[model samples]
Target: MAEVEEVLSHPLNNTDEAIKGTVKLVATPVGTALAYGSLVFMALLPIFYGALRSVRCAKSKNSSDMPETITSRDAARFPLIASCTLFGLYLFFKIFSQEYINLLLSMYFFLLGILALSHTLSPAMNRFFPVNFPNKQYQLLFTQDTGETKEEIVNYEFDTKDMVCLAFSSVVGVWYLLKKHWIANNLFGLAFALNGVELLHLNNVSTGCILLGGLFIYDVFWVFGTNVMVTVAKSFEAPIKLVFPQDLLEHGLEANNFAMLGLGDIVIPGIFIALLLRFDISLKKNTHTYFYTSFFAYIFGLALTIFVMHTFKHAQPALLYLVPACIGFPLLIALVKGEIAEMFRYEESPKEVSGDSNQEKKESEKKEN
Candidate 1:
């Protein structure tokens, strides 16, 4: 037995092959049945819903009243449906394959499964807590349906329903993270959630630091890049209204400045927000809830990026970097006012004058009596 063990551990040509065989044998039965089963389900369920919704849309042709809930535009559906369907089929093949089952199949399916599961729950999370809610003090900055005045969107009200949904999603992610014995996906999920919370808490942050640098990447590449592409491709494929000089692309400092090349994308928007609130008191418009949610999300992600960079000595003190964020917070708030009101349906807030109407009705009833 000792001789055989020594032979196996030797640095012979066949030793590498022997070790690989051993590793595979050890890994085969390690994966739990439940993990594979969930992967199969997640992959299939989205495809099913997407297909069914598409069919329903087809059957109800030209019926604007029965619009698709999953997506407003028809072009958006194909990619989403196709991706989920393909992912599901991939998992199924992995689960059933005899030779490839436990090797490449097991590892790849697990990763795909987490991505699908996250997508399945993200929309409901955005809706309930609504990362953005218009505050009364700043309501005048933009006109909500109620015509209230506010400086920035206030999130004083907490939705228990949303809290419950978030809690459930957290629990699900945590459970999967632990059961799957994976660190990367777990960390990514946690980071995503933290970004959501940071978005909710942003106010009066500045710009022009590593954090801002981080935010540019987070927004332009991670968040805005995908969203802009999808928006243009699907919903707003309309022709660009040509306006020269106003929208001209120049070269040099004329073409690119501190605002254009670096933090300007975020800073410029922030400045516009500040100007809108300062100059255009009559600018009464709102954006979608997603606009605000994602707005702060990018801001917070920038903060995190700065903090992490500082930790590695790639940047200066965290506070110094945050000056830009501190300054930009108000600007972002102003920029998002119109969108926020439309999103929360500020037009739907219960009327305060109704109590006076009720009192008048009571007096009329007394006279009748």
Candidate 2:
């Protein structure tokens, strides 16, 4: 396999320790399964959540807080482009970073993620923060194409609950900064995973497939054909990947050897699954055949990835198995039901997804009045 020339230098390129951690975990079947299960849960939970929220919003009067789906063919390319760029950037930084800037960058993201991921905790947190409390708004000025500039405001209110979450998460970052604890590493990892699933949107099945196909090849070449993926994965110390303690039950906490899964493996397949869920909601007939089928297929595919890695004692590209399973099962179901054409025709419109049809009409009436 071809290896990336280590063009830069970093202390985390401690290849000896990384190989030690990853190599022996294969022998522990229970640990391997446990780690894979935790990863799968984190990955799919947000997709399931967003999809459920999408269905609920479709039935409701307002969904302004819900995410809007993209409709333009050009717009759909953004996520794929962003993913590729980020992947390359991560590899570059991983091979360098003498000052450990990635952790600092991760700290900023973790702060934002704590707020975004804790929305479910908001209702209870509201007892402390309250809705009527003063809100803080930050503004950014953007220059438009027509020699005009517009200011956009983002509203956020920091309260007791937000403070506590932020303080505790900051403490975790500090711990990571000083000691490089797995606890802090995993916390940021989970938060980033949850944030991506919550915020990112894939426009449609066609867009999802395009992204997945490109990434599928990317993953295979890096993982199997080249040594770059494994080399970077071993060396990069950031939380771009999830790490779960494998020997917690047997060897206790001291056995810090972990089973790892990269975020790319999770997020790439997840967006496609979310698209399928929305497609099910759009059917408007209360059937979830495609959605549920794809969900379980994900479990099966992840299981196969782990099984093969353990059996062959090789680092496997998860998307090789995952893309086919996630995309294929749902397509097969649609084919069987003779809804393949309808499935292909399905698209998510922002107005429809956000339940904004009535809201737009109300705004128009105010203008006319």
Candidate 3:
């Protein structure tokens, strides 16, 4: 039990040591509650819708005939690529000096935060401004001194909404950059993560299962099996992780001591939530059973994560609890409904897209014949 406790405490201990005495606990439960609420709001609502729109646009661009959820082949291969990319980034961050890393990360967080926050406002903005505005083409040509070469730039003019969104984002980014306030930092991270979860997509149940299963083991191995994840989580300090105040016991600490849930904890579960939402739409059901069930499961899982963390006095791998809750609850519901097989076999089919692809294929085949 002592050994297990030590493992659980690894993340918090390292983070405390890393931050030094700069922070102390504020109002523990209240702060944490607010943080949890923020995460859920971003995961289920604005952030999610934004992600759906982006995915649809991307798929439409790739092949108008492609399915809304993408193909299983694509879904299955996503994790390997993501894992490799994350590991590589971890290595770079691990090797770089803190000063240099902060410099690079500053720009990245600023730009990404702007995009996330601005995109979140789009739906609301659409209500005030027209969804689609007329486009105007602008051409700019750059000529060398001798007029040897000319390059033309053609682009759509930024209209009322575009300028408003852009202006709003720029102001927010600039304010964060200059202020570097803790609240802004946390909010920026939330926006960026919300956008990420919103934009990510999955093809089907099997894909969500594959993703959650692989990450479940990955989270356990990293948090419990090795020191690497905790170490990385501690050493790296940026808005990529959301910090909630947790040490209310300390005197005069308004927001110093904090509990953190990294973007991974939020996004991994969020993607599954987004998947269920898409699934809800695909079924044409008047109600949203799977989506709501999964959403609540996430709430339960996160609560469990916090409970275990406080109970054990250590850092818990969130995905360890989250994976089972998110995946298991829905499966149980389906089984109870006598729809297990149907759920397992569920695949999104857009017949219009299929017809378009077939037509394209026939046209090419005729030319060949």
For TM-score, the strongest prediction is 2
Tens-place lDDT per residue, model 3, 188-207, is 76675656565555656888
User: Which parts of model 3 have CA positions greater than 4 angstroms off?
Assistant: 1-94, 128-158, 247-254, 349-369
The lDDT of each candidate is 0.29, 0.61, 0.61
Q: Distance (Å) between predicted and true CA of 315, model 3?
A: 1.0
Candidates 1 and 3, the one with greater TM-score: 3
Residue range 136-209, candidate 1, lDDT tens digits = 22111322455235232332223344345445655554544345322233333233322222121111122122
Q: Candidate 3 clashing pairs?
A: 8-314, 8-315, 9-314, 24-257, 25-247, 51-198, 51-199
Residue-level error in angstroms, candidate 3, position 112: 2.4
Give the range of the ten consecutive residues with the poorest summed lDDT in model 2: 1-10
| Cα shift from native, residue 325, model 3 (Å) | 0.8
Cα RMSD (Å) per model? Answer: 24.0, 6.3, 7.8
**Which portions of model 2 miss their true places by more than 4 Å?**
1-30, 54-99, 119-179, 351-369
Ranking of all candidate structures by their lDDT, best first: 3, 2, 1
lDDT over C-alpha atoms for residue 200 of model 1:
15
Alpha carbon deviation, residue 96, candidate 2 (Å): 3.6
Angstrom error at residue 205, model 1: 10
Judge candidate 3 against the unseen true structure and give its global Cα lDDT, from 0 to 1.
0.61
Instruction: Give the least accurate 10-residue stretch of model 1, judged by summed lDDT.
Output: 1-10
lDDT of 2 by residue, 1-369 (tens): 011111111112135544332433322657655656776676566556655654554444433344545444633454456446546755676566735656665565555545444543433455776567764543333443452243224324444565555665667666766666666666666555544554556667777777677667666765667656666666565666666666656766555656677776765666567678778777888878888898888888877887777666567778888889998999888899999999878776665545466567568878998
Query: Compared to the true structure, candidate 2 yields what TM-score?
Result: 0.74
